[model samples]
Structure formats: C-alpha cells, structure tokens
Target: MRAQPTAKSARCTACRIPSRRVHGFYWRSLGDVACFGRPILLLIRIRRFRCTIPECPRRTFAETLPGVARLPARQTDRLRSVHRAIGLALSGNPGARHAATLGVPISRSTLLHRVCSSDADPIPPVRVLSVDDWAWLKGSSYGTILCDLERRRVIDLLPDRSADLWRRG
Candidate 1:
C-alpha cells in the first residue's frame, strides 16, 4: 500500500531532534506478511527532515519508524519474526518451503540469517546450572549445552565439550 506518515514533525535519526521542515520523501518497499490470502508489499513514503540543530552531524536524515521496521530493513519486523519462528522450527530448506506456503517467500539462507540475527529474550538469573554434551555427528563432534536449572531453560551452546567443563560437571 502507498502511504505516508501523518506526523507533523519527525526526529532526526542522528541527533534525535524533532524537525517540521520537510526536505523530501523517499519510497521504501517492505515485504510484509500475507493478507487476504495474498502476499503484501508496503510502499511507505518516508519523510526526509533537515536537522534544525546546526551543530548536529547529520544535515538531513530519514525519519525512523521505530517499532514498525528498522531503517535499513527490507521486510517488516513482524514478517522477519515469522521467518525467524519458521527457521527455528525447521531451519534451512524445510523452513523456506514452509514460509513460501505461508505466503512469505524467503530464501533458505535469508531465513536462516533471520533466525541467527534475532535476539533472545531476557532470562532471569540462573540460581542453578546444568551442562550436557550433544553429538554433532553421532560422536564425531561434541558440544555442550549450558542451561539454567532454576528457570529450566537453555542459556547457551558451547562449541566444545572441554575436559575442564566435564570435570566441573
């Protein structure tokens, strides 16, 4: 959909100072999730604002959408979240297939990138700790899973199952 922000003023991305003088606008294409059984592409009119502060480093900058999408994002945050979920559930080819069926056609590599780039949720303090070894190739390569016993959740995946870690366990 073609749309422009109705806000009277927008803050400079670099300086965070609000400006009403509109320098110009640029079109940004964002791949949003499907609607009405069809894929959605949003053509948003992003306003360019001249920095009112003379000392500010940026002379002109595009207004940010904040929670909607990142400045350099090609797809909406929600769509990326969906891709991340699909990747987490069934990474690589399987996830790409699933996403295509769901009306979000993203490449396997891109989907995997989304999953890796997504930030983990904040976890509570770990009162108790647990470690375990998992084989990457049926005992050929091993790694460690660090978990928080008090929260009953995984904290991180260590690359190696070292002897020091095993001794502590």
Candidate 2:
C-alpha cells in the first residue's frame, strides 16, 4: 500500500514562509519492521510545495510526516530508535551481535557509527583532579595522565613526567 502526506501546506525551511503551491510529487522507499514474520517496505508518496514568498531563495520543499522516517533515511524512525538504544547499551561488535540475535541485522561499524553520532553532553565541571605517571618506552620516555576524580574520566595525557609538566597540565 502507498501513503500520502496528510498536511496540505508546508513551510519553506530557507525563508520560513507557509507555501501551498504544489511543485510536484515523488515516491520515497522506506524500510520498516517485520509484518507477519516478514520484513516490510513502504512506498510513501510525498508532495513538494513551491515557496510563495517573492524574496525566498528556496524554490520548493518536501512534506514531512510525524512518526515516519526522516529524509534520506532508509529505516523507519522506530527502527532507528531501537538501533540507537542497542548501540548505546552494547556498542560496536557486541551491539551488532545482539541486534542479529534479535532479528535486527546490523553491522558492527554501523552500530558504532550510530552511537558516535548520537548527542553526547559535555562532562560537567570537576572539582577533584588526579594525576599519574607511566613509562612510554619502559626505561626511556615517560608521560603523565590526568584524570577528573569526580567524573572518573581521563582529561589529558602529557608527554613528560616532570613536576613542571604536571603543574602546566
């Protein structure tokens, strides 16, 4: 079955103006979850609207549907969300294995990429800091590793083990 956009008008993203003039229509293929134990594909019909504003730089724009897949996205929104969760929980190789076992086929690299692309908030300001020194070449070069004790994450790695290096880092 084919689906069409519900909205009659779309706002131009570039100029921020509501446009009702239809430029054309196109078919977008999307991947969906299993239906009756079989994978499903959706062919959605989308409308393109011409910008009404005279000074608007954008000539046309496509309609967007809520709960559907984003533009240029192969899988559905729900599937992407599930993949993102698995990626965050298991990460990379483990995540791929888990997804395959759950009947959601995904590569290790894709899982890793999804996790890396997700929003990551910056670590909060840490009051407590720790420093440690380690050998780079055993009996030769050495380096210092700085950590935030409150956050429990590495902050920086300095090339020298000197006290001056610790103070600077």
RMSD of each: 5.7, 6.8
Model 1 Cα lDDT, one tens digit per residue, 20-131: 9999999999999999757899999998889999999999988888777885889888888888889999999999998888898899999889878845333577889998
State the weakest 10-residue window (summed lDDT) of model 2. 114-123
- Model 2 quality (TM-score): 0.60
Tens digit of per-residue lDDT, candidate 2, span 23-124: 999998876665654556778888889998888888888877666776678878767777788999998888988877776678999778766864333468
Model 1 scores worst on lDDT over the 10 consecutive residues at 116-125
Global lDDT of each candidate: 0.85, 0.78
Best by TM-score: 1
Q: On a 0 to 100 scale, what is the lDDT of residue 150 in model 1? A: 79
